[model samples]
Target: MPTDIAFLAIAEAQQLYHWLPAALELARRPDVRVSILSPSDQILALVESYDPTGSLRRVRLRRPPSRPDSLFRQPSRLATLLLNYPTIARFPTLVTTEISSAWLRRVPGFRSRLILIKHGAGDREGGYKKRHRDFDLTLVAGEKDRRRMIDRGLCTAETVAVGGYPKFDLKADRQRFFPDDKPVLLYNPHFDPALSSWINHGPAMLAALESLTDWNVIIAPHTKLAIKAPPIVSSAPHIRVDMGSRHSIDMSYTMSADVYLGDVSSQVYEFLIQPRPCIFLNLDHRDASGDAFAHWKLGQVIERADALPQALARANDLQPGFVAAQEAAMQQSIDLSPVPASQRQADLILNFAKKGV
Candidate 1:
C-alpha cells in the first residue's frame, strides 16, 4: 500500500513560511499522501495556494479556550493540540516540530513513523532538546547543522541533512520593496533574553532608529517579540513595523533590503545567505555557547545602541572580507548546492516512509 503522511505546524498562519518548503515537497510525492495539520486560516490558504488541486490535505485546529492569565495559555493550547493527535494519527507517517509533535507522540495510537524537523536555520543555544529515540528520524537543514544536533546528543547520527528552508522557497517579488527607490534596512530582533536585543536595550535601539528619516526601515520582529497590548513598542515615521502579516514568510523583504540589523534571530542567517552586509547587536555580550552554529562570524558586532550610526556606516562601507566571511558561513550553515532543497526534503520524507526506517 502507498504511504500516507501528515505535516503539522502549530505556528500562527502568518508565520507558516518556516514550514512551507517541507510541506510542499511532501505534497508532491506520488506514493505518499500529504496532509497539513495547522490552526491558522492563513496557513490553510497558503497550503491551498501551493496545492490548488487539493493534492495536500489540511486540518485546521480549533482555538483553545482562553484563560485570564496569559501565561497559563500555553499549557491550555498545548492540551488542546494534544487532544487532536489521535485524529491526526490515522496517517501512516507524521512530520512535525515544536510542542505539538512532542505531545502527539505520547498518544498510544500514534505508532506510525515520526520525523521531527528542527526549525531554526542555525544552531542556537537554549532550544528544546528532544531525545532522538522518540523520533523515528530527524530532519536537519545542512551537514554542519546536523552535526550540531548530533553533538548535543539531541538526535542519533541517523538525522539526514535536507538543504532547503521550506519558507524561503516562496516566490520572490521586487515590488514589496517599494517605494523601491530607497535603500531598505530590515530590523529583525531576536526573541531570547540570553541572545537578543529587545530584552536588554530595545528602547534605546528604537530611539536610535527614530532619527533616521532618510533611510527606509522595515521592522520584521520575531513573532514572539510583542506579547502584550501596544506591543511594548515606540513607532516612528520612517519605520514600517510588521507585527505579523499574511505575507510574513515570503523572505523577499530580506533579499530586497540593503542591510540587515538585529540580535541573534535566525533572520540573520537567512539574510546572510544572500551575502548582504549585517550589523549584529552584540547585546548578549558573550560568545554563543550551546548552539553549534556559533562558529559562524557576523559582520560588525555593535556593542551599544550609540554605535548605530557607525554600524550603518560600516554596512554602507561594504567591507569585502566581512561580506565573504558571512557568505562562507551561510554556505556552511545551509547547503546551497545544485540540488533543489525542497525536492531533497520531499524525497527524504518519502523514502523514510517507504522503508519504515
Candidate 2:
C-alpha cells in the first residue's frame, strides 16, 4: 500500500526553499506517494527541477486572480483548502512548512496528520506559540527548540521531533554577486516592523554602505519587508539591493558574503554556518541580558547607522573573538547529526505514518 504524503508549499516562492529539500528526499522513497500543493507556478517549476523525472505529484491551489491583499487572501486560500478538503483528506500525512496549516485540524472529518517543518532557526519570539502545539507532529531544528516548546507548554516531547535545519542540506555555489573582489556584506532584515531595522534605519544603512567603498553590499531584506515597502534603489556599483530574488532565498548571499549584517532574521544563523563575521542592528534597543536578544551575543551589536562603517571595517578582526559564541549559537539553533537532516526528516515522517503519536 502506498502511503499518501502531502507537502504543502502554499506560501510565496521564497518559502519553497524551506520545504524543498525534505520533500525531494521523501519523494525518492518507493513506499511513499509524495505530493506538493502550491499556488505559484514558479515554485512548482522549482520543485520540478529537483524531481525532473516527475516522480512527485504537483497539486495547484487556486488564488484570487486579482492578487488581493493578504488580509483577504488568507480566508480565500482557506476556502480553497476547504473546497479541496475531500482530496486533501485522502492523504494520511500532510506535511507543511507554513504554520497556517494548523487550521486544518478544525476541518470536519479531516483525519490527516499535520506535520510542521519550521522554515528557519531564529530566536524570534514567534517560534514558540499556542498554534505550534496544535500540530500532530512538529519537526524542529534542534534540542533548543524542543526544550523551549516543551518548557513553554506549547507542545510535548512525544509530538515534537528534532531533525535539524532541513534548509542547511541545500547546496549553492558561492560566486560573488558583485563584479569586484571587495568583501561582501549581506544586510538581511526581518519583516516584522517592530524589530526590523529596515523600517527606520534601512535607508540610512544603505547610504552608509554606499559611502564605504571598501566593501560590496547586498541589501536583501525578508520577502515580506519588500512587499510592505517599495524597492530600495542604489546608485553605487558595489551595492546590490535584492528584494526576495530567487538568489536571496537560495543561500547564495549567505554562502558568498564574508560578513553578515541583520536584525532578527534567521538567515544570520545560515551565514554563521561557517562562523563568519557578523554585525547585528539593535533597532529595538533590546537588553543584552534578556533571552530574546541572545543572538546578539554572536555578533557586534550596533544601534546607530553612523557606527556601521567602523563596524564593517573591524568585522574581520572582531569575528575571531565571537567564533566560540557563534558555534554555541549554531548548536542551539541547528542540529547537525551524522545523518543528513532530510533523511532524518524522511525517516521521522515515515515512522510517524506507520505508528501514530
- What is the lDDT of every predicted structure here? 0.66, 0.80
Best by TM-score: 2
Residue pairs with backbone overlap in model 2: none
Against the hidden reference, what TM-scores do the models get?
A: 0.88, 0.94
lDDT of 1: 0.66
* Candidate 2 lDDT, 223-314, residue by residue in tens: 78875777888999888888866788878889999989888888888898899999988855767675566788898999888899888878
Task: Give the per-residue lDDT digits (tens) of candidate 1, residues 1-357.
Answer: 657788775655433555567677776666666778765565577668777678777887664655332211232437556667566667778777553466656666667777877666755664446555477777766666677667767776765455556555664654454454667788887666566677677688778777767678887777666553235455665678776554334666677688888766776777765677787777656764546336336677777887887778767576576876877776766777676667777777788888873
Clashing pairs in 1: 21-166
Runs in model 1 lying further than 4 Å from the true structure? 67-77, 131-133, 176-180, 228-235, 287-296
lDDT of 1 at 342: 71
- Model 1 alpha-carbon miss at residue 319, Å: 2.5
Error of 1 at 186 (Å): 1.0
The TM-score obtained by model 2 is 0.94
* Model 2, CA-based lDDT: 0.80
